[model samples]
Structure formats: structure tokens, C-alpha cells
Target chain A: MEPVDNRAVVDLLGALAYAELTAFDRLAEDARLAPTLAGRAALARMAAAEIAHHSRLTDRIADLGIDPATAMAPFVSALDAFHNSTRPSTWLEGLVKAYVGDGLAADFYREIAAFLPPADRALVEEVLDDTGHSDFAVREVRAAVSANRKLVGRLSLWARRLVGEAMSESQAVIAEHDRLAELIVAGTGDLGGVAQLIDRITSAHTDRMKTLGLNP
Target chain B: MEPVDNRAVVDLLGALAYAELTAFDRLAEDARLAPTLAGRAALARMAAAEIAHHSRLTDRIADLGIDPATAMAPFVSALDAFHNSTRPSTWLEGLVKAYVGDGLAADFYREIAAFLPPADRALVEEVLDDTGHSDFAVREVRAAVSANRKLVGRLSLWARRLVGEAMSESQAVIAEHDRLAELIVAGTGDLGGVAQLIDRITSAHTDRMKTLGLNP
Candidate 1:
């Protein structure tokens, strides 16, 4: 790994931290869509996990002697817009968003993490560990679809719309943060490299959707 | 402490677990009312802590070979009703609920926790430890009230309404659960004893309200 600009690193951490915060907010609200207490608790647990991840990133940014709020400010609007655009209309839609939408975002971050210095890479990897919640989302979504076959079509369409909105928002954030863009480009070795990185993310996202019986 | 019925203990733990889970849901939703990222993260942290406590209670219920969902099912409607009736209208309202409303509930739970056997009592006390988030709520609510004097009257009314609904819901739950009623009566020594215990809790609640410049 090469030396990354500290400002760029902070930008990345800020984006990650705010992402988790907003994810926590969205998942917590979506948990309300659950028809059962156990189901609600499951989504709340996912929301809790996001906050735990948010804390790690925020703490790191604060350790850098920057106000976490200031560091997180830049990415808030884009992420908030992503959540606003992709608000789930039903319980199954919520589950699919938790699974497909968040999974793609996590994959993109993990890929970005790889080109950073060791410590930052490690932090990103640790916080992006979505394995437990991913399994929960997949199980719940699959069970629901099995019980109501018609939900499969609505959820499949929801997954694609979620990914599209997520990517659009991601692009908007990247465009505004030149330092962060430079860092990602450097990490991946070039803009073409960035394209290749996103391609790998897109492929994994397809697999995730397929696992949930939804189209990519 | 005397040997207590495990059935009753499970009942108590279940209720406590569900309370934490519901509180987590409410607090996480309320976090969106925060005006800034730091403020949002602060409320989310409180929400996260509730889930942590919920996990502790749920695990204990499962260890007793009782399904947590089954145990928690009985108390769901009352709690959901209490929260539904007292949903916050503003960020300050949310903070007041987190402060006064949750504080009152915690005090009542702690008082009731005393009548159980040592291990169960300890678990109750541990899970009811809301000191970290309580301090944050107090600081935030007090600051907001200081900024607007007329805000005091509305908030005081809000606090009163919260306690009234909480008590009504609590009475409804207790009336149905004889085993839990027995546990509490045992802890307090008698019906009169339970009254005395509630008095102590109410007094503490008054002090809490006064601390926030609100009338009891």
C-alpha cells in the first residue's frame, strides 16, 4: 500500500461513518414494517450493528482531532437522499433493501478499502463485515417470498431500483469529494481501475440478489 | 433472598427484554429528529445500548429454555400502545421522552427487580443501567429548555402525559400476569409494600423532572 493523503482518508472515514449513521436510522425505522416482534428485533439488531460500525469510524475520525460531525458533513446529503429515494414500501421491500442495497454499498467500500494504507484498510474491512445481518436478511426475505410467491416480482423490481439509486448517490458524493476521488483512483491505480473495481462489486451484488431469489 | 419461581423470573425477563427492544425502536426512530450528525449519532448510541441490554435479557430467557418471543408476547400490546400514544412531536419531545419517560420506567423496573433471587435481581439491575444515556438526555433536554422559557410549560405537560400513559399500560400488563404480580408483591412484601415502592419511584421521577426545570 502507498501513502494516502490524510485529508482524503478523513473524507473516506467521514463518508463511511455517516453512511452507517444514516443506515442505522433507516433500518431502525424499517424495523417498524415487521409484523412480528422477533422480526422487528432482528431488524433492530441490524440497526444496532450499523451504529456500532458508525461509532468505530466516528471515533477514528475524532482521534484524528477533527470533529466527527464536520468530517461526516460532506456525505450526509447524498446518503440521506439515497435513503429517501429508496424508502421501502413494505416489509419485504425493507428486507430486500437491507440485503441488496446495503450489501452493494459494503462491497464497494471493501474494494475501496483494499487500496488504502493498512490501518485504514483494516478499519474499513472490520466495519464492513455484514455477514451476520446479510444471512438474516436473506433468510427472512426468502421465507416471506416462499409464503407469498407474488412478492417475488415486487421485491425483484425493488432491488434493481435500490441499486440504481445507490449508485447515483455514490456518484454524486464522489464527484464532490475530489480528494477522496484522487485517493480511490490512486488506490485502484487509475480511473479504468476504478471501473474494474465497481464491475467486481456489481457481480457480487448480482450473486447476493440471486441468493435472495431476486434478480440482480 | 428466598428461592423464587423460575416461571416468574422468565416472565419478568421477558417483559424487560421486550421493553428494551421497543425502546430501541423508539429511540432509533427519534434519532432522526437530531439536527446534526453528532446529535443523531448520540441518540443512535442510546438506541444501540437498549438493544445490548435487550440481548442480555433475551439470552437469559433462552438459557432458561423458554423461547424469548413466547415470553415477550404477552406484554407487547401494552407497551406498543404506550409508545404509540406518546410519540414525540419534536426533537425536544423525543429528548424529554428519553429523559423523563424512560427514566420513570427504569426507576419502576429497578424497584421491582429487588424482590427476586440474587442472580435474577443482578441481571435486572444490570440491564436497567441507563446511566450513560440518561446523562446525555438530561444534558440535551436541559439545554433546550434553557434556550426557550415557554418551552418549559409544554414539556412539563408532555412529561405528565407520558407518565400517565406509562402507568396505565403498566397496570394493564400487571393485571393480566399474576405470576409477575406475585413476584413484585413478594419483592415489596405486600400490596401496601408495592405502594411504598411506587412512592419511592415516583419521588425519584419528580426529582428527575425538577432537574430538567419541569414541574412534577
Candidate 2:
């Protein structure tokens, strides 16, 4: 096996750490949109889970001798732009975004984790592990979508936009970080392998949307 | 010992639960003001701690055969009003609010918890336990005030306003809930007991402000 690049590892962890941090911020903000206290608490719980993941990622980055803040700084703008662009306007939209948007990012990271060294891969997998709150999102979104078929159209459009914004920001991040891009290409065995990885992520995203009773 | 009044217990727990919920929301929102990712994560962790306490409080409320949401509904407006009026405009202010404002509330609750049944008292004490993040707030606020002596006057004023608003809203809440008010009065042995309780909380608040290098 080829040796892994340390800078690439830092970049990947940095990006992932920032992603979790912003996920916490957005989900917590979106909780206020919940119509009920119970609903709000559920969303807040999901946001808390993101913070825990973020702390772990930052801890691992620190163990690698990088200042976690410095490492996370590079990706802050891209992730923030993605979240800012995809802000959910309502409780149901927030639920769907948490389910679909985070699921897509997790899937992509899992795909890339395969190319990392064992330790980094393990950390990635641990951080990406579902917080078990997806069931709440899936249950809530499916119930709402089923009750009002009209929501199907709007939420479906929202989900697609979320994916589009995510992918655009992700590509920009990769483009700016050559080590990260090289790592992805090398892990895939070639550019074709990267294409296959994208295909896998897209397919999983479709399944996730379907599970949420939304169009892919 | 007089049997604990179920209505009063419910009211107290409800108020505390809603306070936790809003604390989670406000702290998470304030985290965006943090100057660095590490500082943001620290505040986020504090916010997450509030959610955990909220979950426990809600669970305890449910155990008493009340819907957690129903229990929390009554205090929502009061708690929300307090947070809305006391929104922090900067990172240092947010840290001070979390430290001083929450410390004041916790001191008040701990005083009242003494009059409750063992189980209810235990729950109150547990939820009010500091999340150990106060050190972070103290360290940061002190360092900032020392570097910029001008911050002391503004932040001291902020701290006073926080307590003033807190006391005003708290009086409103207690006035509206006869049973909760009775609980506090009885626990203190009379109306004077209530005043003494306020005195204790006030003294603690002053000490907290001093610790933060701000005048009370």
C-alpha cells in the first residue's frame, strides 16, 4: 500500500471538523422553527450530537500536532456558504435537510475514508457514525409528507437544492486543496475511480431521499 | 415533612425545563460570536450540556404522568422573554451571560429544590449542576477585561441589566404560579424567606461578576 499524505489527512480532518461545527450551528438555529417544544428538543438533540462529533474530530487533529482552529479555518468559508445557501425555512424543511444533506456528506466521507490509513479511517468512521437521530428526522419528514402530499413538491425541490449547494462547495474545497484532491484521486486509483465514488454517493443519496418519502 | 405539593413540583420542573431549552438555544446562537473555532466549540459544548439536562428534566416530567411539552408550555413565554431581552452582542458578553446569568438562576433553583421531595430535589440538583465549562468562561472573560479595561464598565452594566431583567421576569412568573410561589415562601419559612433567598442569589451573582472582573 502507498504511504498516506499527512497534509491530506489534516485537510480532510479540517474540512470534516468544520462541517460538524457548522452542522451544530445550523441545526440548533433550525430547532427554533419547530412547531412544538417536543419537536424543538428533538432537533436540539441532533444538534448536540454534531457538537460531540466535532469535539472528537478536533481532539484527533490536536493529537496530530495541528492547532484544531487553524486546521478548521481553511474550510470555514466553504461550509458556511453551503449552510447559508441551504438554510431551511421551516421545521419540516429543517428535518429533511438534516436527513438528506448530512446523509450525503456522511456517505461521501465514508467513501473517501477507504483511502485513508487505518487510524484516520477509524476516526472518520467513528465521527460519521449516525447519532441515531436520523430515525427521528425520517419519521417526522415521512409523517409530514404523507399527511400533506403538497409538501412533496416543495420539499423535493429543497432536497435537490441542498445537494447541489453541497456538491458545489465540496468541489471548490477540493479544488483549493491539492493535497486533498491528490489523496482522493490516488485512493480511487485514478480520476475514473473518483467518478465511481461520486456515483456511489449519488445512488445512496437517492435511497436516502426515497426513505424520507421525497423525490431523489 | 409536609408532603410535597405535586402542582408546585410540576411548575418548578416545567420552569427549569423550559429554561434549559432556551439556554440551549441561546448558547448555540451565541457560539457564532466566538472569535475562533475552539471558542465556538467550547460554547457549543456548554449548549449541548443544557440539552442533556433538558432531556433529563423532560423525562422526569413524563414520569410524573404529564406530557413534557404540556409541562413546559406555561413557562415558555417567560423564559423566552428573558433570553430575548438579554441577547448578547459579542463573544465576551455571551460568555459573561452564560456564567453570571445561569449562575444566578442555578442558585435560585438550588434554594427552592431544598423544599421538594427527595426525588424531585435530586432531579433539580442534577440538572442545575455546572457543566464544568464555567472555567472556560471565567478565563476568557477575565483575560478580555484585563486587556481592555474599558470592557469592565460595559460588562458590569450588562451583568446588572441581566439580573434586573431576570428578577423582574421571575417575579412575573412566580406571581402567575401561586403554587410555585407558595413553595418558595414555605421553603423559606415565610415571605421574608423569599427575600433572604433573593439576597443569597444576589450575593452569589456579585461574586460571580467579581470573578469575571466586572462590578456587580
User: Runs in model 2 with CA error above 4 Å?
Assistant: none
Best by lDDT: 2
Residue pairs in collision within model 1: B115-B187
DockQ, model 2, C-alpha based: 0.92
Question: Whole-model lDDT, candidate 2?
Answer: 0.91
* True interface contacts retained by model 1: 0.74
Q: Candidate 1 chain A — worst ten consecutive residues by lDDT sum?
A: A130-139
Alpha-carbon DockQ of candidate 1: 0.79
Tell me the spans in candidate 1 whose CA falls farther than 4 Å from its real position.
A147-149, B1-3
The residue-level lDDT of candidate 2 at A173 comes to 89
- Candidate 2 local lDDT, A9-70, one digit each (tens): 98888889989999999999999999889989999999999999999889999999999988
